[model samples]
Target: MAQGNIGGLAGGMGRFTELRQRLLFVLGALIVYRIGCYVPVPGVNPDAMIAMMQAQGGGIVDMFNMFSGGALHRFSIFALNVMPYISASIVIQLGVHIFPALKALQKEGESGRRKITQYSRLGAVLLAVVQGGSIATALQNQVAPGGMPVVYAPGLGFVITAIVALTAGTIFLMWVGEQVTERGIGNGVSLIIFSGIVAGLPGAVLHTFELFRDGSISAISMILIALVVAAFTLLVVFVERGQRRITVNYARRQGGRNAYMNQTSFLPLKLNMAGVIPPIFASSILAFPATLSMWSGQAAGATWLQRVANALAPGEPLHMIVFAAMIIGFAFFYTALVFNSQETAENLKKSGALIPGIRPGRATADYVDGVLTRLTAAGSLYLVAVCLLPEIMRTQLGTSFYFGGTSLLIVVVVVMDFIAQVQAHLMSHQYESLLKKANLKGSSRGGLSRG
Candidate 1:
């Protein structure tokens, strides 16, 4: 019996070799990513950058640093992070609706997808150049609290070099993402962001504990915070997995002489269809102006530009409100990009599937739209609550915990995605084992019958 049990375990293990190999490839790729994060861009003063980052504290730079796994603070090669690719993807997705040629290509299936991917890459390069130039300019005028320059060499050459370096870094990250998609598990780009967010967890936890130890944060408060975090995480899990199922009936057609009745199926629409993108996009947009302000030495002025800069400053009530609004706006905007009611309705109609009561085309589309709008409203509220709660806690408690709602959202979503991938692998392995066992039982039954 022991031998049999061992054999069964071995068989299960054997079935998981493919998944293990894929996971190994993913781990290796992530290691490569972490290493790249440390490679400094040319013409940057690492010391000066660190000082500048330290001075900023819990500002927009912290968000950038968190996403880049501290690469931005170090002025590393991966300083630009994956924002350029994200921006490119956003543009290309938007273009599909606006440009007829792009729309035509989008409908071409696999070949069209490849063409779009290429276009996205080109767009990434362009965005990287623009973002890199802006960042480089910011770095030029940025000085530490002690008045030391952030850039080692503050010249046109430094600007050009930094741009090229950051642009190349972003391009390399794009390639890494593609490789992970092809050869590893999980979405490569998402995984990169996941790695960055996870990297900061240790520091955040340590700081929280340190505050508690020093009596800066009471034990009771820490417990309360933990409970809140737990509740928020649970909320995210439920909402992320929440889906509305739309019932569809597919009428069977006559084949030869016999006619068959219809069959029923359901279309599942996720509550949070927009995923973690809204927060990221909102942060990117908000951070750009703050980064610019930090880079420029002149802070005190009665001018409109200074006023605009001050209003947009991180930790400000106005900035938080604007950021939340942008997050909500982007959530709706991105949801629209991913889900088109008209297109889905058309596909369902072409496939001979219709909602039980709704008409095949426009009515079906309208129904989907209505459902999505309600779902998006719920999603927007959830996002705002999750994101704002942490910020409010940080402000009220005055703790050094730097984990924002956006960071927590990314962490939770990525972790869920990673776990889902692993479960899929395990489920596939189990199915294979069950199939083999069924086949073996059938063979044994045949042998007994022959005997």
Candidate 2:
């Protein structure tokens, strides 16, 4: 047993080559992104930007910067992060429902999807340019509360250069995200955000301990907080993995002779049909204004701008309400966008399949739609509860740690997806190994008979 264990790695040397390659690709891509986070844009004063961010501690873009893995704070080439691409995706998704041409394109299968993706990339570029320009213009005029100037040279020249650099950086990050998704483990964008959230966990731990050491947070309170975080983590995993499995029955069909084989399967619809996307979209959309206001504050704001910022800041009542509403809305909206009951019904009908009690055509579609609607409503409510309630409590508590609701959701879901991918790869590897062993055994048997 010991000898076999020692040789285990050698025996399975090629078993997970693909998985190893994918993991290496993801790790290398993220390392590149982290490196770029520190490589400041040429024209901007890196120190000034850092000082400004430090001075504004926990501002709107602070949360955004945290998610961007500090890209924004550094004013790096990748400062815009994946926001432009996400925004473009959201725009294209919304447009599909509103524009006939887009809707038609969406229904065109793989080729159509490629066209939509191309258009989305174009839209991302446009958004990146506009957003990059905004940041550039804002930085040019920005003065830190401590009187540190963010831009050394404020003019059209700086603005133009910054815009081009930032846009190119964002496009590069977007490409990296796509590559990660294609060649690596999890959803690329989500994984990027997950890495950022996970990266801060050690800091969170240290801060928590600091609070305890300084007698700021009582041991009981700290314990309670830990318990709560664990509870929420479990809840998220449960809800995210929960599914509504509808039994599907397929009618037997005529074969080569008179043989007919009936089939039974289940059509699974997840409890959270939108997955982690609704919250992500909601957070991204809400955070945009906060970012704008955070920058605009540096320009000596209007009362209105401050008011908007105050209203939308995390932990505020208005922010919570709007955030919750957007989450619920996006939950339904995204769920609808991704799932087509009519198409599902048609496909099932063509395959001679039906729900146990539902009739085959439009009836089945209606039944599925009804089920989905109820599921989405429950899911939206669950999302609001899990993602918002913690923020509200944390606001009331005034704690410093930020491993909050959305971050938790992103982390948990991404980890789950990553694990599933690993399992899938391992399963495939095992199958290959078994096939090779079987082939070897067959050849050995023929040789033994000859001997």
Candidate 3:
């Protein structure tokens, strides 16, 4: 048994080698992204920026920096990362539901998607400019622990330079993500975010250890945190992989001159159909107010804005409550967008497939929708627990834990997706090889018969 397992693993590894070019492309793109993280925006003092971030004491800054792969710490060109793109995507997706023209375009299929993507790119550029300008202007007012200005030349010239540089960087990163998705591995944008979060793991681990060494966090507390993380990771893996298989039966149908017998299959509905998207969307939305308050000197002084920012800060009850709500909301919203019950029912009906006892058409759509609603409700609750529990525990425990629930979820989900894609590619290659071998054998047999 052990030898067979080892032999199977060896064959799998050999098949993985067939995808070397794609793997290399993904690696090279990530390397370029990492390099960009170190290349600071022109005129910003990297040391002063780091000092300011350190002094700010890790709230929204830490969150953004985590997503940026530490680029925000250095005020690098990639500091904005894929955030603007994500926000733009959310906006476009929402618009698809609200606007008639957009809804019509959505039904137009591939060409429509391309147009929507183009719009998203345009929105990303626009958002990047606004955010970059905000960051640039904010840097002019920011002072490090030693009263050092983050921006040496804080003026219109600096703002323009920074804006242009940051916007260009976002566009370039967007292109890289698209390229990776088309030619390389799994979803490119997710991989980029995954690389960023994974990049920060080493430093986060070292920092946690330093805190423990310095007696900032107790040994018992450390152990508890580890246990919580492990439990949550296992829960996420199991739930993410879990699916409700709705069995569908297909009646006999005639195709061409042949009459086909009834068949059975399953329509798999994932427990968490939204995957990591809800948390990402929730985090991005929740961070917006805090980002405004954190960056704007004017907004910081306003009592109302300050109150709002404080209320929404991580670990705050309001923050957790709102975050949970948003996660659940986006989960259902995104899931609905991705899986249309009415459309699915129509397709199934046209294909003469129906759930075990459910009628075809309207009844099937209702039944599927009802099942999905329950699953999404449960899935959303699972996401809320996974995303908020660790933060709540860490806040209560008073540990300087770096990785948040959102980061962990993204890492795990992306890794699973990447592995699944790799396996799929390998299987496809093996199948093609088998077909070619069979064809070659048939050709040889035909040649011998002719001889």
Screening candidate 1 with a backbone cut-off below 3 angstroms (N, C-alpha, C), the clashing residue pairs are none
Q: Which stretches of candidate 1 lie over 4 Å from their true place?
A: 1-11, 57-59, 254-259, 299-302, 433-451
What are the per-model numbers of colliding residue pairs?
0, 0, 0
Find the candidate with the highest TM-score and give its number: 3
Off by over 4 Å in 3: 1-18, 254-260, 297-301
- By lDDT, is 1 or 2 better? 1
Distance from true location, Cα of 35 in model 3, Å = 1.0
Best by lDDT: 3
TM-score for each of the candidates? 0.89, 0.89, 0.90
The number of residue pairs in model 2 that clash at the backbone is: 0
Error of 2 at 402 (Å): 1.3
Give the backbone clash total of model 3.
0
Query: Clashing residue pairs, candidate 2?
Result: none
- Ranking by lDDT, best first? 3, 1, 2
